[model samples]
Target chain A: MADPIDFWFDFSSPYGYMMAERIDTLAAKHGREVKWRPFLLGAVFKHTGGQPLPSQPMKGPYSKHDLARSARFLGLPFTMPEAFPVSTHQACRVFYWLESRNPRLAHEFAIGVFHAYFVDGRDISQMDVLEGVAGKLDIAPEAVAGATADDAVKAHLREVCEVAIASGVFGSPFVVIDGEPFWGVDRLPQIERWLEQGGF
Target chain B: MADPIDFWFDFSSPYGYMMAERIDTLAAKHGREVKWRPFLLGAVFKHTGGQPLPSQPMKGPYSKHDLARSARFLGLPFTMPEAFPVSTHQACRVFYWLESRNPRLAHEFAIGVFHAYFVDGRDISQMDVLEGVAGKLDIAPEAVAGATADDAVKAHLREVCEVAIASGVFGSPFVVIDGEPFWGVDRLPQIERWLEQGGF
Candidate 1:
């Protein structure tokens, strides 16, 4: 089997959430495994002078509209959270925590977090919210709390984010296949083409 | 016949150059005409707080790579000019001048300008270059020079740009079909889908 494609995204990104929904199935069809890695886009933005799409002047409103439009276009459920572009640091930590123990469970946990924000339009910022999501995933709220505070898990997430930065990941829905980088969910067609043509 | 699709782009935008090659055929396929409106992105950016893609910190480098990759992926000729992101004010003025008289001639003129900057890597900022491009189309160099200097032509472009901004065109290759706006070349699939399904 070919190596898994590195699919990196921040939990707060709408496009990231959309890509998360489709990437696994798309990769499976191409005989490629996807390593779902959630990282903090906030940290990455610090060095890159990047701001959330909605915070930027004109790009903000257009991006918000595009997000909802793109979701509908893709036939996916989408509802903007009341508080958008929230901090995903804690969510990232929990993802790494769950991922360290069980990759499959982590994937489900990530989906739960995505659903909590994107589908239900619920805020996933507070610990209780994350705990509720983890609880739904069969992960005990106490376990999620305990794992979130673990020094090793925190350090592991920081390390992964650092690596993602060094690897030129500046945006959500960033995909790297065999050292080739593709940013944005729109690159899915190009990704499919790359897999089909074995590099164009 | 339905209203023509509003295809707005700046000559300096790489993605805009790519879209110029495909939008016509795409629109024609659906029995729709395209209103190729070239506006000054820099002027629009002033109101929108948008900088060129290569000016943004991290996104700059990635955009440069993707521009070339996108051209190759689309099987189109692409050569980055030595002086990129050059001022397209004069070129735009010429476009409006030619467009006012003959929209067809203006379309061909726009293609010549795009090819000169993107394929031939020529410095199009010079008046001589503009005259040369016009000469190839059998448009008199003197007439080209006279049209570019026309005060009405200059104001016409400014008016067009203001209209574009009012219509919520925040980026290059922005397409508005039946009152729906789609941004970026990546949204081509969605655009096609929208036209086919009459809105999803």
Candidate 2:
């Protein structure tokens, strides 16, 4: 019908995690193809004249309450993984690998990272945690880790991060289809329906 | 057992309309009393370093897409009202009157305004349109026009707008309970759960 849908995501976001869990099913229901693109969330924010959401001092109780209620309503758990605001380089690299090998696995990897944080309350920014999530997904844990230093993959992740910025991607868990961008996990179904309409 | 909740809101929001549609029911489910507070959303945004969600520019497509999905999910007929933005002074005063007089009707009036704009595509920013909305509610067509300029009510409206700024309320459809603020309509349930748990 139209071009495929691109989902730009990062490992350090709870809303991204929540959207990853449901987007695939919704996409399939609408007979649309989804491409998962993982990038560094922090860098994108820095480039886009925005700051890390948690960086806002006035937004503590308000953010927590909004997210907690959202989690309950969406039937997802809520927790700020101890390693939140953690480094996302390795995760983004692994995501790049998954995108090349199997996009479905990339989706699973994103979900694993989300569960590792909000559900298990683990330090996902840690190397061991990333390895564990990769292992569970049957990806070559060592190979994924080894590839982190590869100039090619590193450069690839770098390009995607830049591309995410240029695309007007203000936040993570972003969906772009037909030149339209939808942000927030709550907007997942809307993307799917738009995909279903195929440019109506 | 904590203090009763102070519910902050501006009438010119669809999400607030959605929240008002069910907030009281949710409150009753939790046996919590809501102290309805009327505030100016324009002022809240001005003081909070925030912009109307659509004004963010980056949030354009996301806003349209998300609202479409939310409408479908909620099974409510919604349209992006032609009048993108409107001031909430008159609406807020009527709300203040209803807040002090008949809360149930106040809620109806709020929902009516939101529905008029979001569902029927009416320009609520226009006084005549507001008059129509008020007349439809049997609120005395003049009440709508009269409240905006009434010295006492306008002053009260100003007081609440100032309070909203002081509280760091930067968004419309803002929900605050017991001095704790929840921004966005999505957080309504958490307020309910908090109240249910003997919370403020």
Candidate 3:
């Protein structure tokens, strides 16, 4: 692996969660390391003209077929999350917390949240729900609380998103390596190609 | 050209106007023929969950960038219509009417509408404005009157949108060469590629 690639993630996005779940294997296939950088989706939407799921008109039909299509394409189970657009404050806090001690655990917790909302139909915005998800990922509740509440961690989240926006970042699950913003999860193959050419 | 490629259009779409103004040049370059199909965007949106230009937040920023970008790209004066999302019923009606008798006149009128909306910012949906534009294109005002009143023309408008939806067409300026749908004006080059290959 050469230089590490940074993946900007938001807790509420199914696409972000999907990228988090599979990026590692995809990165490994190309011989690279992924550094997960969590951010607030609400903040991202403030500056960018995007919708919060229910607002996108094409969402229903596209999402209806997305599951079966995504499953078959990626070889993964994709159930539409019920507790989507969930509050990610606590979940994101846990992510910041776990990243300090166990980045792998943080990654697992994110995957758990994705499955919870889209597949299991659970509201993941609540504190208890987020904590429960952390528990499933074998993370201590205190670690999550500390990580989520830490001013520095919260600042890091804001800083990353601001950086993303300043650089003309439009949507989530985008990775910028060597100044190229790879927009969608579908562009992972293109990302691999860049790293291979030592473009990073 | 082995077959007539469908060029789907709506009045509110600047990109469609841009394509309409210059598609013939592309046709000549690739040795292809085009079949224009005009439809009401309101009907398409009602069926597909699409938003009007003013209603879409992303469109604001995108439109600002697009006007300049398209002008440079297409070598045409790109301008926004004043009374946008203007009723295209009149425009579609005129297209449907002139389609059989004088399609060349219809093409001229389409160019007139594009210049009126994008450059002059005129309201296309208004009958008076349409008649004026028709006059500018040297099309008799009676054609507009006949177009608006004819039941056959109204049915033709409905069929255009119905055919659009059935073909998985999601937006305006959609081009279908053979059975493959090339969406968006940006896909013109790719559309030409298929045309060169005899549309496979």
| Share of native interface contacts recovered by each model | 0.67, 0.30, 0.09
Of the candidates numbered 1 and 3, which has the greater TM-score value? 1
Instruction: Assess every candidate by TM-score.
Output: 0.97, 0.75, 0.60
Worst 10 residues of 3 chain B by lDDT: B58-67
The Cα RMSD in angstroms, rounded to one decimal, for candidate 1 relative to the true structure is 1.3
- Model 3, residue pairs in steric clash: A80-A118, A81-A117, A81-A118, A82-A117, A93-A148, B79-B118, B81-B117, B82-B121
Indicate the docking level reached by candidate 2.
Answer: acceptable
The sequence of per-residue lDDT tens digits that candidate 2 reaches over residues B1-200 is 54555667666666766666666677666666666676777776666566666775556656676667666655678788766767767777777766667877876777777778888888877778777777777888766666777788778888988877777676666666666567766565556666666443
Instruction: Give candidate 3 misplaced runs (Cα > 4 Å).
Output: A1-151, A158-200, B196-200
| Candidate order by decreasing DockQ | 1, 2, 3
Q: After superposition, how far is residue B40 of candidate 3 from its true place, in Å?
A: 1.3
Model 1 chain B: weakest 10-residue lDDT segment is B48-57
Best candidate according to lDDT: 1
Q: Please state every model's RMSD to the true fold in angstroms.
A: 1.3, 4.7, 7.5
The interface root-mean-square deviations, each candidate in sequence, come to 1.3, 4.3, 7.4
Q: What is the lDDT of residue B44 in candidate 2?
A: 67
In model 1, which regions exceed 4 Å deviation? none
Which lDDT tens digits does candidate 3 get at residues A1-200? Answer: 46777787776766676677778777777777888776776776787556675566544454444434444455556666655566776666667667777778777877787777656767777766777888886667776667767898887766766876676555667676755566556555556656676542
Residue A159 Cα positional deviation in candidate 2, in Å, after optimal superposition? 3.4
lDDT of 2 at A144: 75
